[model samples]
Target: MSTPHDRHLLVVGAGLAGLRAVEGARAAGWAGRITIVGDEPHAPYDRPPLSKAVLAADEPPPVPALRSEEVLETLQVRHLPGVRAEALDTERRMVTTTSGELGYDALIIATGSAATTVPELSGVRGVHVLRRYDDALAVREAMARSREVVIVGAGFIGSEIASAARARGIGVTIVEASERPLERAVGPAAAVRLMQLHADAGVRLLTATTVSGVRSTDVGVDKVELSTGETLAADAVVLGIGARPATAWLRDSGVELDARSGGVLCDSRLATSAPGVWAAGDIACVDGVRSEHWTAAGEQGRVAGANAAGADAGGATEVFAAVPFAWSSWHGHRIQVVGETTAAGEEDHGDGFVLYRRRGAAVGAVGINSPGPMARLRRALTAQTNP
Candidate 1:
């Protein structure tokens, strides 16, 4: 333990990003005290399997939490669970949480994000959003029953849930406001393929569809009113719409948050506008853009934790570089995408594999239903950075 004036590193949020940050700090030989706080009652566990593997089965994936209290104890890091940060006293270098006030030398904000929901339909029967483990459990319980399941949005989450529901022989209809299910992430060209995959899996997918309001009966969903003035009968509704960063409490904290994206701004070194303060994870919007993604979130947290520990983080020269990536499995087929995939860009590599080039370095690449290309691409990307 360091001296009293040595400045303990206070990390808010106990997700993967936060855990990774603590590890990075310890790796940098920051003998100072390190404490992490989180609002969730559970330890920091893996989230990716919550939707695909955990919810799909009767039992949730046994997530032996990473860098938890035990791991933190080994690293001589403090863990403060069941606390929610309310305000930040940047001038005094102190943070006020529900538990108490903690003065720190540096702070790492990795609050992550929350599920976007239609609160107006809260009293309704069965409207759900997939964000937390409990949300998955509730949705999974509903998925066990065979009823008309109306899924809002055809994004990865929506599609994956639909696939899971379909796997159990549940009826699923995907409602997308856009023409393509995942046009926003993978671009229209690749989204078309995903849409085809949905169709092949017996999923009812409607494009250019808008949900006016959700009205469900006591038993379940009666019908979903559409903007086009049509009603589709449904038993349950799962809203897979995008998520907004949880940063409402940070207002007036003088921390620079993106007005449009709703994410805390940070430099390449992961330092926020406030001195000795940094932000990370989905809640943070580093480099103006690129706020989402598990890998990016973890990487951001690691960099922030390292820099906050008083290391030569290379300042703004440090680049948070990671190929935009996400993987999903549907109907026994696994899909992997790496690099910059857009919803509108026209991609053609003559054989359906996309290769994103910047100054002829192949900055990004996307391949569908092909692990060979993905493995090769991952190797190339890693070699470029590792070498």
Candidate 2:
């Protein structure tokens, strides 16, 4: 391996994680030539806003850029937009792209993940999955014309879209296989109140419902069939069934990935099993901790990039030890959560109180709608994590 000062760094993915990785590498004293490749033609932009502000507006908000073009130019990072990485040649220290092969001394994989879609919805018009900028645009356009929108799954993405659709005077029906929304994350108690928020907004929530298949015609989807023998008439269908890590290209690259989540497995320092490679963001499972939050992605990207640079520079390495934090916006309320919200013991403080998830003697997680307490709890959690 070449010294960090003499190495060529290549970062995959043009999202927030990839952009932050370049910044983090430079901050760690890496002056080597850096190249970034992205399948999307557009530059790095904020994705969280896609399902929120952009989808809710009549005129979709302009793409929210994470970093300005001038900043990238100032950083001297070469960006190859609209390019897909076909394969990784670990032995040759080269990356095979749609254009050609490029050699690299160090590689950072932050390709992120793709929104999950069902096979039954494939080739079906008006059935959309929101992941890229274009996906949100299409969904927003559909909402503008449709009176009823059927959204599969009641997770974060699904709930957000429901809110967006309702904002545009479109009736929304959210279908979830689980008994409650965010059952895996926030538990049943808090989920009840969360579900109430949607109901209060005139959105319909169908719990314990399974989508059998989608009924579509030549132009677009007409109705969605449910396992409960109920069919919902819809002009548009949005699949919020979650996402899987984008790691198919790394299949033959010899990088270790967790079988369950299909996320790239990394050590304490976010270093992958492959010698010259590191990973972060939704694509990474660091020491068994896999988080899909936007904040977690950016932080992991910083740690991974800095550690990769430090390793090459033969300097002090940084371990990724940040506590997990994620927040969701619904009905104009900020739902903030810290640590693992799915812990065994849960305490419901009742109306207007934070739900605390506990394991043994320690508090494992905290979820609240109020920003004040959430901020204080976040500080406490940060101290606990650091201490």
Candidate 3:
């Protein structure tokens, strides 16, 4: 029989979730070999700042490391950077990667998500998507040389990028396909208020619009064409329409994945359909919901890691029931949301706070520049769920 030290815990993806999984394993009394594999060349780093601070800084800032090298060393984690997981053999407990095949006793999948791109924008020099460190660097560099930027989405990522571009004194135009920006995320009323922030900041908000095509010059893109038969001059174009979970490699690995979102389907305990495996972060679809927030990623990572360790040690696994929360900063305004924002009924408090209710109970809330109200609502929601 394999001893405790003989077992190996392999974590795929080296983002916040993946790093936390390593720490979670250690905290859960997992005294075994641990290895983290990442396709990015750099070590695990914080991604939240890539759209804000990283893009706004005049000089390139060092990628924000999630954990110091010393910390990872103390954790005794073998990190394989620039290694991509190609396939998985759940039966054999082996994973095929760009470097080589790695065997593990327990596995945690936190591959996260990748930015969706426009098909026609392929190979366009001035087109960009911000997901990785390199992508941020490239966008920052492009923003410096560009006069006007066209953002193709009105989501958090696009809004943040627009904020960064405006901070650099570059002209920004946001083309959102929906009738109102963030209508689905924060409700129509709150989304309108949020949209006003862009307008106040001198950003041209084009609602119910889509980018049909692009006009490129020899150097790069020169103009962006809209579906409304409008053409706007653009030096740089950022595609922030959406992101899909990075679970393509798990398709044939005997793992159950959501057909719509391409996310790995997991149970309440974060356990995947395949035995000896678990999923977390943006790729984990539990109860038909996949949270892409940073907080959820860390929280789910810890739970999944602990559960994986428990399975290896024949211990009881913990259930993942953390409340959902997410925050975003746009145009110097802080927007916070907690719990399920899709509740049936909503009450606008008229003070930048919107409370969502289901069956006359507080289920979620969205606060704009109102931290105190948001905190109270969050606590109330937490208490409601816990009780």
| Highest lDDT scorer | 3
Q: Supply the TM-score for candidate 1.
A: 0.90
Off by over 4 Å in 1: 1-6, 60-64, 67-69, 312-319, 343-345, 348-352, 357-361, 382-387
Instruction: Single out the weakest 10-residue window by summed lDDT for candidate 3.
Output: 1-10
Tell me the number of clashing residue pairs for each predicted model: 2, 1, 0
lDDT by residue for model 1 over 113-150, one digit each (tens)? 88887777665778888887778777887777647788
Q: How many backbone clashes does candidate 2 have?
A: 1
lDDT tens per residue, model 3, 1-387: 122998899999999999999988888888989999999999899999899889987888898899999999999999999999999999999999999999999999999999999888877888999999999998999998888999999999999999999888999999999887777687777777788889999999898999999888876679899999999999999999889998888868999899988999999889999999999899999888888899989989999888888878888788777778888898889989888786778788899998888899888888889999888877876776678
List residue ranges in candidate 3 displaced over 4 A: 1-3
Residue 37 lDDT in model 1?
90
Return the clash pairs for model 2, or none: 4-312
What TM-scores do the predictions have? Answer: 0.90, 0.96, 0.97
Global local distance difference test of model 1: 0.77
Q: Model 2 misses residue 337 by how many Å?
A: 1.1
Query: Where does candidate 2 have its weakest 10-residue lDDT segment?
Result: 359-368
Clashing pairs in 3: none
TM-score, structure 3 vs. true: 0.97
